[model samples]
Target: MSADNRIIRVIKGRRPKVVVIGGGTGLPVIVKSLHEQNADVTAIVTVADDGGSSGIIRDYINVVPPGDIRNVLAALSDLPSLYLDIFQYRFNSKDAFFAGHAIGNLIIAALSEMKGGIFDAVQQLSQMLKVDGHVYPASNTPLTLNAEFTDGTTLSGEAEITGAGKHIQRVFVTESDLNAKEPPQAVNQVIDAIMNADVVVLGPGSLFTSILPNLMISNLGDAVKATKAEIIYIVNIMTQKGETEHFTDADHVRVLNRHLGEDFVDTVLVNIAPVPSDYLDHQKYDEYLVPVEHDYQGLRDLGCRVISADFLQLRNHGVFHDGDKVATEILNLAFQVGTMKKRRY
Candidate 1:
């Protein structure tokens, strides 16, 4: 083990159990960094996706969308680079039948059909891929995201909700299968992970579509509220156009608290470093708007312990959280919490 890993083990007497809840491109970046730090990570991925290759597959096969899950699996997999490349490879547009589909998404779809559910399929594939940690879809079945805009109009499906271009008032999830008797609920293992985790993380993903879908599952959200784990919200560096335009960091926290019906977030990680003006390629990343403005007092009023720092990383003319830096802060917080529990006992 590396010195840092050794120190964590020695201090905590075990690997810190971290449950990261979210989906989209940002979730995997942080997951990969936490794996490098030797934290026992469990990624609770959102399955409310209804876009891109995942949308096509879901429409045809009646299965949970696999794009987000596939990315998270790649982040945690210990397979060779060549193997991962092949798995993540997307077919060219000229290949009419397979165009825009990722190899991993196809594999996941096949596995889900064979295994009878997404949870089992992902677990089986995790072993096959030599994944370093656990990956659990927020629910056992497909979930459709529903949103009520500020104008009081409602929409269903993640794609439709996002494309409406209206201010989202609130978001919720429902089973895509209207005939299903039971409401959407996470599996036992997912609940166990949340209840037993040392820290539970939310965000660095879209506030309405990516993060809230998972939490809107009643059982999962309840577990998060009741868990002894210190809940942390990784505030987005930039405001998203269709979702969080003109939103401050406090607005993000406020929305989360409102959705969950409590001020459950114990801490917030705010990126204080400003994005350079006219630096972003707007054509490439049209979804992101301006940098999220700060509201320290507003955050404090929400009962959040705000940690502000230079957590900015500028790459390819886009701004993002420096995963390594964010991971370090998370581990430090986990260590402190673990030590306190040990001392009290």
Candidate 2:
């Protein structure tokens, strides 16, 4: 169905509940678009980040990395643009102690300290920012992402794993706290959102670091696999050199299924539009190597419904998914799922 018709249908019924799971710049783009579509959006942000200001904060404060959560908050916030700009502001290198730190990250760190937990801190800040949707941290505490590479060597930390430059065999999460014996798990709200969602979306972010960190949390992955929500994977526009070099779209889905022990993805959104030659500024996006290759049959063999389209958006010499187009497709699928549920009753 057309996006216009889907929008009309959605308006005549209850808003679709969408739960987007991932981290990085790509996630906020989709979350913001879903919020614009009037979907009841919930973002389950990865807390395994251990780089930049977030890493600094994690080392010093021993709290969840606030970078991704801060961006997701800005995306869903109904606050004025100026306020968001200030919240998102980064200190210059000259500002020694605060250099590279975002204002929102500091605020989140402070709140996490005062509120006694990152999840509670984010929720309190959400209300203050007049956020239009929920933003839940993947865990209450910091998580260290661990990877076992094809060479059988293991690495801990998201930064270390990515920098190792090895073909990853599989990845998992562990509590950053050495003293903590318990396994990592998402808070109840995150699991509830997944189970109750009309649609659950993953990716447009790093396959291992960004998306899978949350799923590596045992119960959260179980909820996703067992949930009735139509799971959608937005295949990345380009394969990353260190992570998924020479990977096809089906290879992406394959890795996801292998990790979770099930072929749980219901739909795969692949970008068919070709990027203009010489348009990409490689220095700015050094990690991305080449456009991901297509393998439709492989995807189908894994029980995925492929939806390839012109979902590409080229801007400022960077390639990205067109947020509006992707959101439209998501909403259409969500509405279809909703309709089917109603008919069954």
Residue pairs whose backbone atoms clash in candidate 2: none
Give the TM-scores of the predictions, in the order they appear.
0.96, 0.95
lDDT of 1: 0.91
Question: After TM-score superposition, what is the CA distance of residue 117 in candidate 2 from its true location, in Å?
Answer: 0.8
Model 2 residue 312 CA deviation in Å? 0.8
Superposed Cα RMSD, model 2: 3.1
Model 2, 144-176: lDDT tens digits are 999999999999988788888899999999998
Top lDDT hit = 2
Q: Candidate 1 residues 193-280, lDDT tens each?
A: 9988888999679999999999999999999998888899999999998799999999999999999999899899999998999899
The per-model lDDT (C-alpha) reads: 0.91, 0.91
